[model samples]
Target: MLLKKSPSNPIQAASMGINKTEDQAISGWERLRFLYEQPSMERDLSRRIINMAFLTGFFFGGVATSAQARETFERSNIGQRFLSASDVLKRQADYAIVRFAKSGFPMGFKCALVSGSIVYADFLKIFHCG
Candidate 1:
């Protein structure tokens, strides 16, 4: 039986996702060389533009939400203090915003208010700055 010769190029081996210790032993230096030799993957122009637009939209949306939240909080005449969601709910408040902003997330949260003062903030566990 004649066994076919395996590939000697590191780039070919890595790109194929072949397992290591399989007769073809690729050294670290070879892998780095392969990475340097390979050209970057080309993407379609429209796809790239769409991705950029999506990212920009997401970023601007977050900024807008934060600004809206800050304005709402300030206008309520409540001290610039934020409390936990559960804590806010437990406190005595005449009305609640029901829709508020938490740091670093694109979702809305509920805030309890008492006489225009923020009592507590209930938000998702995704992310929060403070």
Candidate 2:
């Protein structure tokens, strides 16, 4: 009985296939070394431009929502006069801007506006600073 021909005794074939991939590791390392040695200024600049555009859009959208929220909050005058969906959405959008900007901040007005439900928390402050 030839153990090599037996499917149940295929341990040697499995180990040989694994060693074949390991043998090509040198070629993979050489290819990586070639790329690593080349200049990447163009890639770097393109990456920077893409990053800036993304960040600008993010902050600009946040600021726009904040402004709209401010208008809604002011119209309500501390939300005592009216409480429409637009007003609520405006305040929420503005609060989201503040929350996104002041990440890792506590849930209060001293550090940032109190966002979320009023029943669980206190009043919401719509005030902003220059």
Q: For residues 2-111, write the lDDT of model 1, one tens digit per residue.
A: 98565676447555665445466555455434444655332133234445554555455456565566456557756645578665444423122223213322321111
Task: Give each prediction's root-mean-square deviation over alpha carbons.
Answer: 17.8, 20.3
Model 1 residue 2 distance off true place after TM-score fit, in angstroms: 10
User: What would the per-residue lDDT of candidate 2 be over residues 1-130, giving only the tens digit for each residue?
Assistant: 6564422322222223333233333232333233234444433443455455555555654555566656655665663643687976676666667745653222222222212111111111122123
* Residue pairs of candidate 1 with colliding backbone atoms: 85-121, 85-122, 88-120, 93-114
CA error at residue 43 for candidate 2, angstroms? 1.4
lDDT of 2 at 56: 58
lDDT (C-alpha, whole model) for all candidates: 0.41, 0.41
TM-score of candidate 2 against the unseen true structure: 0.30
TM-score of each: 0.26, 0.30
